[model samples]
Target: MSGTVLVTSRSFGSGGLDLERRISDAGFHVVRAGAAHELDELGPVLGDAVGWIAGTGPVTERHLSLAPHLRVVARYGVGYDKVDVDAAARRGIVVTNTPGANTSAVAEHTVALLLAALRGIPAADRRVRRGDWSAWYTREVSALTVGVVGLGRIGRSVIDRLAGFGPRVLGADPWVPADDPLFDRLERSDADAFATECDVVTLHAPGGQTVVDERWLAASDRPVLLVNTARADLIDEAAVAAALRRGRVLAYAADTLATENHGEGASPLLADDLADRVIVTPHLAAQTREGVDGMGGMATENLLAVLSGEPPVNPVPVP
Candidate 1:
């Protein structure tokens, strides 16, 4: 418990160097390496390490077998789909994530994408650059009803921001209590029901292909606006593109896509017809300076807590 803590980072920017420094200053030896190579290298030092701050590396049972001294794993962000939690739990390793650390940053970015899609910001910018400055306003946020798919930390924050914009907010999360003050009204119905009732549907759920295929889009009553800043697999990209082409969806702004980490090089939703109607951003909802610093600090704190033989601030359940 008094030795080095291996930190496997996956293509983190130079800001990660500062996080390494903070870990070192906290009186623990740090072993920093890129995730691509670290999975192979972890076997060598796993016996000496007390904790690990993992990025998007594959922490399989094979890698876990080497870490007899490992106590906890602190993920850099909220998403833990990349890590094998069941394997870690079987070995008594506690996995933790920095949940609310990047809530405001991601929520703000989600709203920004929503507004950008609704107001045609990208198209308008391109038009202005092409020397066309005709005064035009298509749709307003106030004129639309927003359906929030998940009412978690980021979802609630987005709902709070949307409240100021005067848009009717409908939430669709069974995990949240019906009497919660965060939502104007909770829709116990499925995603299709929420999609049919709202003009704009924003996603804030964790990873998974929850809303798959064109059935959800086809079920909507109008050309809905889809905003996803959470995970790419929540919606079907091909189905969404088809909906956009058929005029069933007015626009879509996604910061994440199912093919993002698939190494496919191009998005399935980036078709020529859907390009102008879509706003696709890399998975950068938590890339703000403030969010980065907060995530780094919280990750370091979680690792340090495990090293000190205390419960982590955000421990991932052993299941």
Candidate 2:
């Protein structure tokens, strides 16, 4: 009860202050570790903390080695790519991630991006303001074949939303169980087949893997509409821009980028020539009130469980 719980994530309490109060009311001292991206900066705090609610930082073995009393690391969100799971497991540290918490929000955003990219919503709005609306024709969502890369929770949610649009949704993910109910409504496709056959390609795979690279885009018969709401690492931006310029890719809509903190004119996709073909959001797909609250609650529960010497509600499975 006297041990300190270090909350390294700046966003852990951002959903609401009630969760933070709950941690304080539990007779445990809560401290902020200031993003904690660097192990050395957090070394002073990690040396004594028994629990660490981690953010999107690199939790390397060196960091784990520094945390002698660290029993658990409750990741703030779904992806734990930054956290070294094998290294933590080797040291008997529990790691948990909040799955399905941001599924609905991200799925909704994916559909929004689809509509925006296909309908030219943003461009048409600008034209209307400038007093010039000659003609505009966009692709219809109902007619296109959408190829979803991963069939995880968020991927399945995207398909669920796409169902009402009457689009032919093809899912490709070896991780999905054969008996999953989604198979009844969704058709299976291999990675290459999905890239070649589908009119639109949307990525929902995990991080640390590039599913939408030059090779993946090269197989497509036509300029494909590519959407990515999953992770930045899923796509190669330079390759996407090159394809977009050469008319090999129709458009790209994404809620993620190679890096979050980009200065003025930093990304290649920001060029004026590709402006009409690329639409990017500032990673706000899963920042909805409902999504944030769900993530916070789940992360808090995970921390409590590990602190009490019990298993987390959603522990990330080790391979």
Candidate 3:
């Protein structure tokens, strides 16, 4: 309770919740560090830190080894793949994430990217700035067959918003029960089935494996607009770029790049020719004010709970 509370998440307390003030009021000194969570930079503070509000950085065994007093690691976002949970668990440290906190924000961003790619919004804006005002035809959402890859909280929210568009929504989630209410309204299909039926395919699957590759694109019977607001590893960037070149993928819109955290030099999706068909954002899908507040509040609460000898609301199970 008297030691420092280390905060490595860049956007941890930037929300309306004033999470830093709350932590400070609990008699713990709050310390800030880089989102990268470098060993040298965090070594000094880790020794005195009781709780760590981590970002999308790796919390390896090396990091846990440095912090003898560390009791909990509250991930500031829903995804915790970057964190080394086994190391924390071995050290008797609780790991928690703000699940469903940014669901609405990310879902809205997914739909926005879909619309942007569909209507060529960025390209049109660029043309207008250069004084070219030629009109181009675009397909309406109501006319396209949209396929969603995951049916989790954010995926369900995306479907709910897409309902207003009146598109033929096809859902794909092997994890979800077949009797789930979502399948009642939409046809349940797999990602492979989407290639032949869907005009637009948005990815919401969990990361760790490549879902979209050259083989998947080559199986397509028509051009498909691909949107990914989930993870960078979800799609094979090189394959996607190739598909775009061949017109198999009409457009590729995503909120992340494989080399985004470092540099995008290796990604073929950023090539000059593919710029017309590729749209990439800097992983800001869950950076809305409301989303930030929800994530910050939940993370802060989790950290405080563990430090106060109470169980966290959202503890991640050790696998």
Candidate 4:
């Protein structure tokens, strides 16, 4: 092998794609590391690494400084928010992500979470396990006005799935053009309308912006079921927990949490009183077998391209 390619993502070859063998065949040694991306743990490996396929952990400027031989940082998922693209660019390192690789998986999971929350599936299952066979009253999807925040690939895919359920779908996104054909299928609305008008709102917006906060929840006239398969920061956990307690938010289902790697105890949504109305998954919305393979393949391809002196397939633009 000419150089080492660091693989920090736990789910890189989880789909049985043999991505490590593919990297090895390209004349690069593959080195496994923890997904946490600890400086101490990665210092030794970073010195000789030519490429890195990182996970959700933050890749900072300090990390780029340590990897003198690194040519590329291949993010093993759609979102590259965790990776410091600007820092990589300053150090002449290419940053790439697997865009659209987990679209279908996340879209499907979003709908699953919506249904799970709307129907109280998780709580119902728990009741059954405790020998309670009573029917759980839940509203039908067809009767509710569903809202989708963010009209990107995954958001649009979610709207496509919601069409079959016969609900009047409302989409919100400041970025999507008003003339876009997406409005022909679903009604267009702003952020404020989502809180007041929507009976069930599913979040698909990018991270860094908090869409659902105390103010947003306060705008709601009635209880609404909220589902999030996107970033955890999209909703304020404290606000959501308070809403759930006051019956403003009927249910809160998310595939992620603000305190994931550190501890779940730090999250207010996991409170004992809110257990029946909250459904939290371990950020596995995009962990489907097909999604895993797609992300791994794209990440590997991008890594190989940059290592061979070619532009990456899905390079994240440096700001």
lDDT of each: 0.78, 0.84, 0.91, 0.91
TM-score of each: 0.87, 0.91, 0.96, 0.97
* RMSD to truth, every model: 2.9, 2.3, 1.5, 1.3
Candidate 2 lDDT over residue span 15-65, tens digit each: 754788888777677888766357657888888888888876678999999
Candidate 3: which pairs clash?
Answer: none
After TM-score superposition, the amount by which residue 100's alpha carbon in candidate 1 deviates from its true location, in angstroms, is 1.1
- Where is model 2 more than 4 Å wrong at Cα? 33-36, 129-131, 177-179, 261-265
Colliding pairs, model 2: none
Predicted structure 2, TM vs. truth = 0.91
TM-score: which candidate is best? 4
Error of 3 at 211 (Å): 0.9
Candidates ranked by lDDT: 4, 3, 2, 1
CA lDDT for candidate 4: 0.91
- How well does model 3 score by local distance difference test? 0.91
How much is 127 displaced in model 4, in angstroms? 0.9
TM-score of 4: 0.97
RMSD versus native structure for model 4? 1.3
lDDT of 2: 0.84
Candidate 4 clashing pairs?
A: none
Better of 2 and 4 by TM-score: 4
